[model samples]
Target: MTTEERDQLRRALSVYVEGAPTAPEWQDWNFQRAVPDRQHRFVTGPVVALVAAASLVLVVLGGITLLLRGNIPEVVGEPVTTMTVAPSVTATTEMSLPTGPVNPAAYADVPSFQGTVRYFQHDPALGSPGWQATVSVRFAEPMRFMYTVVEERPGDDDFLFLGGAGTTFIGDGTQIWLDEADDLPPLQTQQPGFFRHLFYDSESPSPAWNEICGASPERIGVETIAGRHTSHIACSTTLEDYELWIDEESGVVLKMRGPLFVGDLHPQVDRDGGFEFTEFAIAGVSIPEVKIPQVEIAGFFPPFHMVQEIDFGGGSVDTVEYWYRDESTWRESIIASSAPSAVGSFQLVADGQVGQCILEEDLCSVVPLEGDRLLFGLQLPSPTSRVPLEFVGDHCDQLAEETILGRAAFHFACDGVRFEIRGTWVALTDPTVGRSDYWYDKGTGLAVKYTGEGWSWDTQLLELEPVFDDAIFVHQEVEEQASEPWPDTYVAADGIVPAWSGPLLDGTTLDLDDFRTLPGSEPGSGGSFVVVYDWFPTCGPICLDGITDFQKLYDKYGTTDWSVTGGPNIEFVSVVDDDVSVAQRTNERLGITVPTVACFADEIDPAKGHNGLCTPDSPWSFWSIGVPSWTVIDTDGFLVYGVTGRDYDFAELDSLLADISGLTES
Candidate 1:
């Protein structure tokens, strides 16, 4: 057959496979049957090759259809089309009483919309490299909504291709599906007013808007945006200034610009750094048909596995593998590439039970999954209809309508914890405290971007796909395994305190046993007590509070002569799990008068007595889950009382002190 004929045949075959009722008439025209005007040529050469290729494609497609049978649902209903409704701009027009408080209720209506938003950030102080992300969003009520994200950064080429296929919230926005098999809870519980503003150009005037615009917005005259005439308005908050251009007829925010602040209890905006929308477009969108795939155990028998490599900085890397078994049961295995012997594994069953096994220690423990324990799974928060306005306290103030990437967001400032962002990573100081600056999309109530002291996260939507896999919700029996009890050494209150000798910050080298003897007296004289306080310099504000409390107690009773009672004289010593310089710094910062000992040296070599006081092998080291643990050692070197964490029983401490002082209770 001629090349032209071959091309024609290919097109005909494609059409037939795509649901054509009948094959093309060319199928009956065979070259093998002698043509009336041409010499007979048996079907050979290119024709045979072309026929074979076409046959293979058909076979493959047929096999795929068979495999997906019953799994892929047929489209049952006609395509649903939703129109984008533009809000009336009269309420926002200059003639509409611009001198009064803007009524929030006037902008409460929200319309559905579908569009793309892009974000870009540049900070020369953080280096010449910058960050960028693209998000695509689709919204349809009574069904499901989707958002996909693709991110990129200079010098990080791999992230350019690493896209978040985004996530889908199914059913009345209660259930969420992520990746291919992971299930998560909804991001929001109710529809937020901001969604109406971001997606539909409709306004939902919130308290934040009233607080910011109520003061009196300066009208900057008229401006044109995307061919639409808009009224420009300038506003300000306590932390940042903003400029917004609103469509005069639709009341939709067409363009916005302002400084970016971290979303935390304390608003921290970078005077030199800000974000703006580069492009925004609204249009009607058709809801695509989506089918939740059925999950069968037989499809993933011998276990389906996935591996991920994590870089922990400082040249340390770890490999994590997820292995799925049965239907809802899976195992996570972690191996330290630098230390092969350091291996850990966890098994999660459908019944919300999780088991952790330490291979090197030959130990395993099983526990129920709840609260923060869910972090072990591949679940994440979903964007919901309600912007978490509760996080904004009375101290918060509305800033401006800011365009981040392409999405119009309502920017607000409030008291929040401060954080520092170096590139994409964020580290918050005083992690327990602080509020964040929120850039909420008015249309979706989705927080497209949030910033706080040291950190920020921007969600850029990507393509949406069905993520439901019922097997992920299946429950399985939790296999019970005998676990070894945790080791108890200095941690035991009744155990004998281990012997240790070290130099104090006051230039005194002494053994713990020395405290048992009175100066210039016999070795077996009166008993004495050693009060050891263990703490970390990097602990949160609560830890500092603990230090202050300890200092107050010491000042009131440190020198008291408890020797009159049967109890020994008290000697206070603070052991810090850091270098001497850090320890000294903490003592000075807290105004602690007590002597402090460093656990490590500047070299930080544990073998050379660095961190020796806090090392697990040290007898003086008391195991604590957190900072500010207290240990009381009697004159005989026995641990009398050991407490871990905060909220100590001060009554007990007072009672012990009274007994030692030989004083009777009132």
Candidate 2:
């Protein structure tokens, strides 16, 4: 590459390593409206205020940056492009359930109780009177109970969340309706909220709940919870059963135990499962004026985009009010999404605009929709939050298949991104969450909505709007015979990079300086690792014992800048048998390719002897493993650190690297 081209590539790599740019001031307020009933608020006691203050403080806390550096084998090139291979479909079992006998009484008696619970409270810290939430439950033919909660503090806003006392319900119910939509904030598409944060119906709760409930009733028995005598029962259809406590003499229900919110996306509260009955008085059925808005009643954002304009009723007129959120802030711009593309492979168009408005004049009076009010649809991620495609490294692995509700799912980790795909349910180590099931269409390569407790949203693929030049999308196939790997022909742009050079059990030279620089290394920079092996050639008990412990460490942190290499050390072609010279090794290892490997040794000469370059030299610190123990020089070519003999503290090695990386950062 020319000097200018090389510099440009270097700069690009540096920018990527530094991460995406800090967002500019956000002005994209598509929708903002005041609640009609401002007086209707929930009771937030001092405890709530304290919790809110803590959350706010935690968000503002800053963190320290640590610079880490490492090197992989020469075979793997820099800026690794990871490919996620979906697992092959497994054969369907002829008989779905294993032949084990079903327990005689596997199902539990699940009570269908309907009632709204209310509460009143006061907080000293907020100096405000508490709020109230009134919930009405209907079980059989409108037979129900209504709960009303009142907070009587001195001074404060009295607005309660849905899950708060007064209106909270425990039965399985569909959430994500227009009533609660208006209160939410606009959600960023790519960074969707965690599944636990969303709502789920009570019937099908989280997978973890299934595992706990699936245990025999004996395993989930009666216990005194919160000083209340209670009995635990498992429901056959739902993840949560029933915890019922009654008035011993009257036989009337006293307290109820189950999931508070009835949504697939509700976050789990393991300990807070049962509700104690306070004062229950009989009153005429009353419909508390519950003003369910179209947006999130509480502040919540949806994953969507919006566009708006202020004036211009005619063609080519003036007065445009364009706004968009770049992840954090709303931004105002003269240009609109309808305008031509400026950069990247994709342009995020709001779901509201696509297939709706055509000309700028048509969109002139378009008012921006409130983010919280947007239901799931064809929403695009805000432009600023879209991450550019980049590769992870070689320590990727395919996890086992997870099956749920007769649909199977697969999970794997490659580079750094975790790939989870749902298919036909199969048995998994853990019970599957109802919402985690994402069906990907084979033909279209897009996600189909997975079944939730009671409702399902179609996560269908929108149009593949082209953002890149046609040429960029075109793929090329390389002829195997024509494609030779690195270190075989060319060298890194910065020239010779010295690495590990030692003797294999076969007396062959072992040099591994060729792999791509561990994720973030500048040109001309390098690192080291010790490749220890148990067997001379083949596998046996000795080999197993020698490698087992080291393998454990590698698994915890695979291919880190500092790691202990595994596998038989015979992969490297020895110089004696192959007649591969040191210069040849250098050429083969330091070439342009995907994940290449290099070496510190030059050649294998039986007569002239192994290349002397393997020893300590300038810019490289040499190290020893044992008598026959050998390692390459450090970046500076000096011999400074070494674990000689059979003694080595694995913890010390990790700490040393951590210290070095810390110093570099400092």
Candidate 3:
């Protein structure tokens, strides 16, 4: 039969089978009782046999339908009756049930409890030494109250200094705003608040279950925590391994110990040493009233006044004074100073203009704020109540409940970002480069403690007092003088490249003069052109492709006998900002035979390292934001062409080479 006819037949058979009376219904039929005993037996016996045969036919037909639909994989010489229907059903059953020693469902219903949670990390390499935050959370019905006092331990501080105070909600309920504190403008996007149900309802599996659970969760026996008996569950993922201790009777998570994932691109978290949470105690719910400061400004009351100390790296510190006049309109004054001297000061009136002044130079400038410069130092972005859980949902795995900083939290890994459930606070470390950690109050979402890689600031929570003084937003009056425009410090394209020397992979020191000179002429030759490639060993595929392209160019011009004798020889060299070992590995991987130089002996020190003709002050910095930069120095040692990032435009390079070679030939 045709496929359509077979489908129609299958549908008709299904309808007939569904409409047929069951054995019990058949027995209850009036006709069977009405008939004489001898005749009834004869009739019922054949009818029952026919019914059973028809049911068998329906089952066979259903199997055939599934096979035609490709739901069942076809096999040669295999009876259709032997094939199992819905193979996924078996696979799912395997995944959900424990093949190992632990029954995860046993401890799934953790009783709801409220308490304070403290989570902290210490790494001497991070410079700040150690940082931690403690927040009080009350786990109850309509809303969970979260309140925390922000504190910071600066490089000079022997003890934690009070930074600020704020509050947050952990459930689907209206915020209890203090009569004195006015609500700030809502963020552009609604942030996902902490779900208290995750703690109270243990039946709902944690987000990281599949990732951490693996084939099965192993029960590590019972342990006492916070004076309660708890069942320990051991779990692991490809990233890190951790343990979760759930209360034996209550099922509430008591503690969790694991390493946090760090970095966005090249993620590296300390595997051996990680963050730990303990001393979880049940505490009474008490949310202190938060007072918002009111600042008087131009017939309007600015309800927020924030004093932030920002370390702009490189030993420069900027003390920023912020006064929010509504949402869009605000005033920011940044007093930047380095060790031994005050570098400069800038006051940004985000509504219209920006005024800047250099202290020692007696230089001042006022520029119109527009486009990209409009938000210059006004650190106002739509505030988030908590980190957006959806953004990291796909990367999240192996979730376990634990008490952090005295509050119930679900510890999980998202991509490389680790979460120790509390407020929307994040401590990020890019071990590939540097580390930056910030603590924001769950309620206010204001940063309390901030420690950057090079420059760091720890803000102690001062009193949240009213700003009666309007003069705080007003610019200080200086001696009346015309403002001078700020001069650009970066080198422009076509600027002369400063001479520098570094040893190449071939064990020969090459300087800019070496490339500037013609093949058989003196150093002042005006026809030679140099190509310097600036790249990093860890720059991935694009860098390798660029290296291959450069190698081809070198083979075509540098190695060609006629090309060298015919015109000015083009010189090609690569300067990598990595160790010799890394450079060597990359060279071997890419099959690169070109002369490569390691800028630093052991590490990537941008200040002291020789990265081609490109330095921190080079205009190339504007284009080469990340790696794989290329610079072409003309015969006169002037930068003729400079481009950042990998370019697949071999035709452009070829055309430039042809034009330069033509000039030499002429």
Q: Write the per-residue lDDT of candidate 3 for residues 316-400, one digit (tens) a residue.
A: 4556555555433445444333321223343434435544444323345555643432222112222121233332333345355
When sorted by TM-score, best at the front, the candidate numbers are: 1, 3, 2
Single out the weakest 10-residue window by summed lDDT for candidate 2.
60-69
- Global CA lDDT of candidate 3, please? 0.40
Worst 10 residues of 3 by lDDT: 40-49
Which lDDT tens digits does candidate 2 get at residues 227-330? 32333333322112333333222222334433333211122221113233333222233322221223212111222232222121212111122123322223
**Candidates sorted on lDDT, descending:** 1, 3, 2
For candidate 1, the TM-score is: 0.34
lDDT of 1 by residue, 83-133 (tens): 343433343234432344222223323233454444333333334323344
RMSD of each: 27.0, 28.0, 28.5
Cα miss at 590, model 2 (Å)? 41
Between prediction 2 and prediction 3, which has the larger lDDT? 3
Q: Each prediction's TM-score against the native?
A: 0.34, 0.25, 0.34
Candidate No. with top lDDT: 1
Residue 154, model 3: Cα distance from true site in angstroms: 20
